[model samples]
Target: MSDAYNSSWFAEKLTDRSIRGIALETSALIRAGALPVGAKLPPIRDLAFSLGVSPATISEAWSELRRQKIITGRGRNGTWVSGDSFVAKPERLASVGHYGAGVLDLTMAVPDRALLPALGNALVHAVSTEKLNSYERSRILPELEADVRRTWPYEAEAFLATNGGYNAVYTLIHALVPPGAAVAIEEPTGMRLLDILEDHGARIVPVVCDSDGPLPASLRQAMLSKPVAFIFQPRLHSVTGQTVATRRMAELAEELRDTDVLIIEDDGLADISDAPRQSLGRVFPDRVIHILSYSKTLGPDLRLAVLSSTRLIIEQIQSYRSFSSGWTSRILQGAAAWLLRDETTAEGLKEARRLYQARRDNLVRALAERDVIVPSGGGLCAWVPVASEPFALVTLAARGIAVHPGKKFAVQPTHHLRVATSNLTDRYEEVANAIALAASGG
Candidate 1:
């Protein structure tokens, strides 16, 4: 070890011995220039011995630092002060490569702007919402709750409105999951989901998925780790676009029956997916938390999503939220409620679903004609198997097209690309040819 890894000096600088304390003190030291970037940290055992604390404490503190990107390296390589900053980058989201001008970007799994329902009338109706501008935080508008309840998969004990689907997931996880706790989520899930889990330092246990949805056997094996929660897209998976069949839902519920783990069902596609919404919430009402997002069906600007669970869990998430925004924008919630209840919006949603499915089908059929078979699941994107992620990415870029690498959405290695088909309104054959070529690493 170099003189920079002076255990005695480092130990003296750490007055607080608790995990949080050690992490904070170390961060302060690095920011204050006491520990310069590139300086190697003392080994866990040596630092713990010097500070009169357990090695576990030192290890956890280091883990927190690593999560914040303040330190780098692990195991035999030795830990080093990588940076003086304190921001935790969402690794997966950041890794989704950027595209330049003229590149046909098919990376983001988002709804086509042209298909989104008009929000003008909804916003106009929102002006009449009761207690419109009150400072008092309301968990959700009464009208909104009633509208959501009419379609809720179960008789939820309570409901809480949030900024959007991702916000609801992030808030709930932050409120319930402690650092390093295991969380089982569907494999090849939305990249944003993985980002949230990693940002909170949760040990992500991937539940592998098949065509019907998450495989029960994989979920059972993941449960062996005793994860705090099991999250999945029930209606339509945002990544693979596969819907969890009713039978699969029952099997998943059965696999989780013995455990008290929280069940989080994210219905991200909302009305855009034709599949009937399914939830394990009906089976385990007290433990299940269901989130329904209208971003795709209505408009992303609505910034509204609703979550339902037992009053206790809802209250916990609301309390955590109080520390920040306190409450979601009522205007957005009211607009969403208006849109949900409007007949015109209903028709628009039906049309949007038809159009998106058509786009997805067109891409699938086009690919099939070129000897590339991809699942025609319902969603804004399609997962296409590839010979190599890197080679496929390079091949697509060479053809002025861009797509997300499958590795961005999975914990395990995957050779695939997530191509956005929502806006693939025309030239399907042309784009499909490029994709098929990329898939074959040509």
Candidate 2:
């Protein structure tokens, strides 16, 4: 690499604080072979001096590339380009290789199936004993509606059950967010939701987040464009595992109240947060469509979630649901309602929370021992800053471990990897050992 750092691309890309354009440019060079195999990256100080940015920023970019296996740092040997064979891509299915061989799975987010008892029995009962022969009667069963209200804590009239959390989000988008309308989401957000929102005709707008959550400056800019809604995981955010601060939550509520913007708060793992805050729905119930699911708490197979809004939005969304799903399955709805009321179900949630917290604690402690700074725990995932996302990913894969590259969650490039801890049951020690191997970059 030349001592004369190319300033053009870095300056242009650094305009967006959250988007690391320069790092991405460097990644492309590595991919295209312009940065030859075993070639060294420019020193951080020299690169920063040339690019007119802080050395720490350049260090972060280099670290992310190292983690992804695009570059290798051999201590005083300096960072070198990983061979072309090392520039591998991740799998289509997320979290496939989160665990090393002979280790517990800590990278996936599904709950233990054993915790939730005999859902099949409940499903059987729902199918055999329903007296509501009419579609309307079965679909809007009083018992089912009561159950939805209990979990959501919204007026019974304003709630509806959906196929799953994803379905609930699609329903709201179909009913409220018009095609091509601007929709703002936190950068490094959930990929599944991002794809769904785009498919439903949303013009994506990303709001950058910090330790405190979405920066107010980002929100201020996003609101200027008149987005239809702002989607956020207010409780346990997906990849970063950072909670939305209470002060920022109040500020956001006030900001949205003064505009026509709606807030879609995904509280999928609300029960797991250390300090579970009230839903944005509770603060401004009329303008927020709150979605919650038993997937993270119970298990993904449950495929049941509640979507609640003001009576106005509920009536509007009901029309869309009728045209789309006709109605959520009565049998499934009954089963979810029954599950929520079960004392065993509540106990399972408490157990899941404890397990996840412990796993995260173990992960942080392990990573810290290796000189890796881990983000504070919000839930099952940990966003650990590293040297090069591609480098780390490849090195880990060779050692039979896998992690979600942080760039997948980014609206653009930011040098980090989100290491999930949910799958690490009794074998977390083995998983930690594998991570240590990757950190060693052998």
Candidate 3:
């Protein structure tokens, strides 16, 4: 845009910043009128050279600005500030378009039902010829708990079975996280997780991540606010399918080394994930809470997951649950355990994992062919970086494609939107073309 940088305050604020910090300060400059809305930012190389920082830093700063709606990319026309402090973008659900038959929805993360085996068979096998009367039994049945525990990377003194992972999250947030406290979460997290956290009266502090998962610097920055817990999806991370590298997980564990911060690993996709499940729980077993949900793997109707945690948290959950729904039904527990050992179900799950991986991988390749930022793999969804969230949302929606706006999941400003790839098994090119157009300032 401009070779002659007008803002003297810009370079001054560039000191002591991770790329994200630099972006935040540039936003401050725009809000203060140093770089007024509609004014073009200085050329990336020029600003980076002027500030003695990398051009990548300037690029990331510009990206983060666009994400916040503080700036807009006008293709070859160049980038310009687009909004002011008082004119922040609204967070409203856009009305869905009715494209009827050809419409493809990439919003929800659910699997293709046709790929899974018959849950009726599993349930029938579980309930058939069994004594159905149980007046007194542990909230978590002993046999089911033991079976689920065998899959965990680490051992727990006691296990708690919840209706599902989200239920377990609610239990944890209510019982563990003190009200009015703040918790750390991955930026661009699930919208429902945000709701649960807010419902339980917890403030959110986001940690920015790359494909390998949350950056160590971002984690360090997030912890600076002293959040009460770190709730992150370690594997098959929804919307991105980003499984944290073992080395990166080790780094994260080291960061929480001496802290009291509770770490919750949301292993949502469970056995459906192509990657071998890895957890930071092994690093700090006493301080970690691991939840593995099977709804995506078996059948959503099962509503079951294994919650592995320390005795203290387990007891707290039980005590809190005593006055509520009591416990997960023993029948559902039996069904889940029975399904886990079912040969046909196991083969179907294996195939489902392959199909999800293929779709996700193909979508990533398709998007990348068009030069869209495709940070994905090992999950049912993909995260595509865009210059503007609203522009992408509207542009894609108008093309008979539906997807969640990236801003809906952002705790801080970010420039990416999630696309559920599983349903696009046969429409990769079509969806990718639409995304490329939208991301190109449609």
Candidate 4:
């Protein structure tokens, strides 16, 4: 690491974007022993000066590298090459798909595509009106801002429209958590988040849940001992469709107020709910990081989500977004905004609520018919208490169905399973048959 290397060669290489340019230059540098493992990158200011790009652009490039797990930032400690084996990209899916082989996908919480309102025609019309140029130019376009206000009205300044609910989690985690920290999550949550936390070098601390929600006692205990970030899918909680009761939300906030913790509210399947509960941020606005997407309400392919927090967090995230792509997709945001404004979409959501309610009713009936007990909630999943997790999982898999075992959700077992009710089709008999067989120890 010489001054010349810092000022010239590194500057030229960092500014280049071609795949070949990147691969060739990086490979050449590595082979020539220029870039090595455990090497420290120059500060964004110095690097930006050398590359002749804005510091924001250099920071975005660094974020791209960080997302790839190519580099690790230690905040004041500066950035260094990562020592972790598995690298995670922003759009990468959890490796949970391998379990899907030979198994019916009763495990996924995917919404029915027919339920999403058809607003593509309006989107196309809006895109032509918006006159987009490139990724950088369209991020903060007027229509996208209007869309954000229309869909989710708040006093936030910046918005980063991501691919899907899961991508929303990925981007936010990358922005909030530094490498080698701990993130607190509910015991027995969606496993994808656990993978994301681990992939980003944040250890997962399981905060126990009582009848109301995350146990205040357990959260306080965890906070007292170590630095941990809180992650929860507040509305339409995945795996288990459990909504944190609004009254309990106030209590949870009180428990967290004295501590310095980051709260990530993963409202992934939020659109499915009708009644408004006080958001955790409303309780502790400065400490909360809220994320939501249309994956559960709109189609899975619709790939749009929103992130919001206090003004400081919003600006910090904007700093990251500014360097990366600068704004949300203008075309997509315009379409989504139009959809948000559409009465038809609202009607479709009403119909979807009815249909999903019916599906839940059907599952409840099926469970009652077979003597299997399930908890009541407004989301698309059910938390079923069972005798054995492994036995239930293997039995269901053998019967051509896939259900997430409770142990997957917990750092330790409580002998419960989360069965997603959203995937049920018209085959009520088939689902009933599978539940009965699993219950009878098949």
Clashes (backbone N, CA, C under 3 Å), per candidate, total 0, 27, 0, 4
Best by lDDT: 1
Q: What do the candidate models score in CA lDDT, each in turn? A: 0.90, 0.70, 0.78, 0.68
Query: What's the true lDDT of residue 230 in model 2?
Result: 95
- Arranged by TM-score with the best first, the candidates are 1, 3, 4, 2
lDDT score, residue 181, model 3?
86
Q: After superposition, how far is residue 56 of candidate 2 from its true place, in Å?
A: 44
What is the TM-score (0 to 1) of candidate 2?
0.72
Candidate number of the best TM-score: 1
- State the lDDT of candidate 2 residue by residue for 219-328, as single tens digits: 88999889989998887787788888889887777667788788888877756765655567766777888887767765667677777787788787888777766677
Model 1: CA > 4 A from native: none
RMSD of each: 1.2, 12.4, 12.8, 9.5
lDDT of 1: 0.90
Error of 1 at 10 (Å): 1.0
| Tens digit per residue, CA lDDT, model 4, 250-337 | 7788888888888888787766876563467656667776777876765665567777676677666666666566666666666766
